[model samples]
Target: MNSEGGKVVCVTGASGYVASWIVKLLLLRGYTVRATVRNPSDTAKTEHLLALEGAKERLKVFKADLLEEFSFEQAIQGCDAVFHTASPVKFTVMDPQTELIDPAVKGTIDVLDTCRKISSVKRVILTSSMAAVLIRQPPLEPNDVVDETFFSDPSVCIESKLWYQLSKTLAENVAWQFAKDNGMDMVVINPGYIIGPLLLPTLNLSVEIIVDMVKGKNPLNCRYYRFVDVRDVALAHVKALESPSANGRYIISGQSVTINHIKETMRELFPDLCIDDMNGEGLMDGINCTMCVDKVKNLGVEFTPLKSSLRDTIISLKEKCLL
Candidate 1:
């Protein structure tokens, strides 16, 4: 084992969908990861993670809650950097502030506040969704590719039922403000629709949508989204932490494709299964996803294509008997 190489890294929401990938990558790279989950006693929730390649020696699980105060300090202890990926994601809401905004904003603040007291923490890698940036933009004329420089205007955000988008935007905004005031080194990763292998037998809500479609779950047959591999997003987090120049926000998305494309790809791969339930044109037409990825590429991070991601996910589902 490389003694000097073991830079302690803490990942919040370590058992969640995207965070799981982040934790897996950290452990694979020999980083001693302090992973936070709501209930550490629930061995069943994290057994899959504990069974990963190096979980026994390199991974440590901490009990932490987003709504609770000072619950993250012990997890942050002795860590060189923290990847704050825990925040409630909800698209529809009766009260936006309570359901979406508060937790998102408060969770970030709580983590940063804890980090403030930890002198060992030099950087924080935050997971902010592309929804945070794209939701605020007005309707794109045509093929308008947005970049890190563009931000979602809050005014436009209120009109749509994009509560989750607002949550991510508000939370990320707080993170930037807090980092500026506290002199914390922070980098934000804004990823498009995350798709990749499941670390657990049961799928998270995000992945469940795709799995549902594969299982012929959605009847509306909507198919519009540019997908990014969760693994690639995970790598971006690690790279952003390691790269000194990788500060500020970086958009990490793979090939842009419509929902029809996803259905067709899956249908082609799994013809033995039901392909009739998928509506090829149920998705909105002419949605723009020209989110410039040059910023992340500059850090030498490569993204897996959406097609390959779909294939990998299908195989994983089959292996787990979910298919």
Candidate 2:
């Protein structure tokens, strides 16, 4: 790991929408990034990142899988920082523990184990989800927002079919526990519904929801919930990496609004657009559900307005022919 100028930082799931943005921002800032993808041979998955600004000299792609041990060592070798952003997120899995929990928890441990053996690795930035924090506590404290101190009890997070929340909560808890047990330096970023264009057309679980909503494929009969821009989420990841004082967890979300909030915003912003109204459950087009961003803002993150995010998302979908 290079602690001096232009330290190399490893980003897991480098081809993912959020991780790709993190890679992009790192390259723009002149930091060397070692990006890991499951398949190095898939040029389609990584070409956008290579074409990004400053990517030629600043980015390197490594083939790594979350299912394998020692796979991340080569990618993280000689890097001062690590960003673990790879996790499986699905609404319904026949076996939640196997399909979601195993990789989420085990992959984190594997990466940390690699870091423990490498003295050069000094810090770890984990990309968790707000579902790990907000889904459990029904009556959220109006004034007291979720911070690093808050956690979603896995046992109580079964209201939604999205078992991915349970996996994330468990994985984050394991990260903290491992950090404490091994005396490793680590920080976690729990972002709300992330919305933005992908570096590539491929979808990771987080961005897939927004894409599906725009495409009128939302199966969840829910009301609205908080959302954040992928750009802001990427910025937060890099910020957490550089800020020495940033330790523990930070909630990163855009403005709060329900499904209706998104629909109305899009309707006003782009009158020609035909956005479908999903008759979902919790945050259906009728309610207002949002989150407080004091934590990440304190770390110097600026969130994009929800309207802008929705507009950009539609544009992205159109460009990708997903619309």
Candidate 3:
């Protein structure tokens, strides 16, 4: 229990890259946090949370799973806010339903059910992705900005064999519907290509873009993505929670960029590394993603610069011997 009567914040998937940072910031801000993880008994996994700044006094870890309905009840009980950052983010899916859709949708159902069961949850911040919004008829014209009003077409994504984006779309759509029916206070933070420092040695698919470039796997940037640091995404979650006027959805992405922009900058910074082709920008590919973050910006959130975010990511990978 928090002695200062600070808000009791609940963060699902506390061991994850983004959620871990959310938990850290919550504790550092004097909030008592009930962190839910799949396996609390696993010392290897829970140790990182336990080692956080105020974990011993303010942070509590509970075992919860997305598949297990009502499993989040214990952590969410009497909590003022819930940060639902738990989602299945996999690039390679052998079975889309069992691997991607089931976990993403079912877990959301489970978490929202817990929220319905608990009256103390005043605000629920959902970690949705641009994957849920980026699917569209491509031949994408520049300045066609995507914001809260746009949603990715599930049928189109499924037809195109993009299982990950489809899953995100379905999952987020279901969450919004559930919240609307339940008359719950909810806000969704949709981030794009989240990349940042690693709390664990495990590599996230989002950060792999930077990792592969640093490792000489990707010689040049062929595609561009709207990039945002994991830390900035975490802060956006907090800002959404704290702002009373915040409602509906907010896009949490930075300026559009490609890996080559990062490569050339890294090459300039660390001349020793074998990073070359500092001037090549490959076929201008993917959706000409133009995302607007005015809503989240209205909540007083400023994003980290792309170059600094990538630099920190590379340095962290090197420190962990992952590069």
Candidate 2: tens digits of C-alpha lDDT, residues 96-117 = 8789989999999999999999
User: Which of the predicted structures, 2 or 3, would earn the higher TM-score when compared with the native?
Assistant: 3
RMSD of each: 2.4, 2.8, 2.4
Please identify model 3 stretches exceeding 4 Å from their true place: 1-4, 219-221, 276-284
Best by TM-score: 3
Per-residue lDDT of 78-145 in model 3, one digit per residue for the tens?
99989998888887889999999998999998899889888888889998888888787653467787
Worst 10 residues of 2 by lDDT: 281-290
Candidate 1 residue-wise lDDT, 143-250, digit = tens:
788889777766677777667877888888889999999888999999877778888767666666677777655522444566788888888998998887888999
For model 3, the run of ten residues with the poorest summed lDDT: 276-285
The whole-model lDDT of each prediction reads 0.81, 0.80, 0.83
Report the C-alpha displacement of residue 212, candidate 2, in angstroms: 4.3
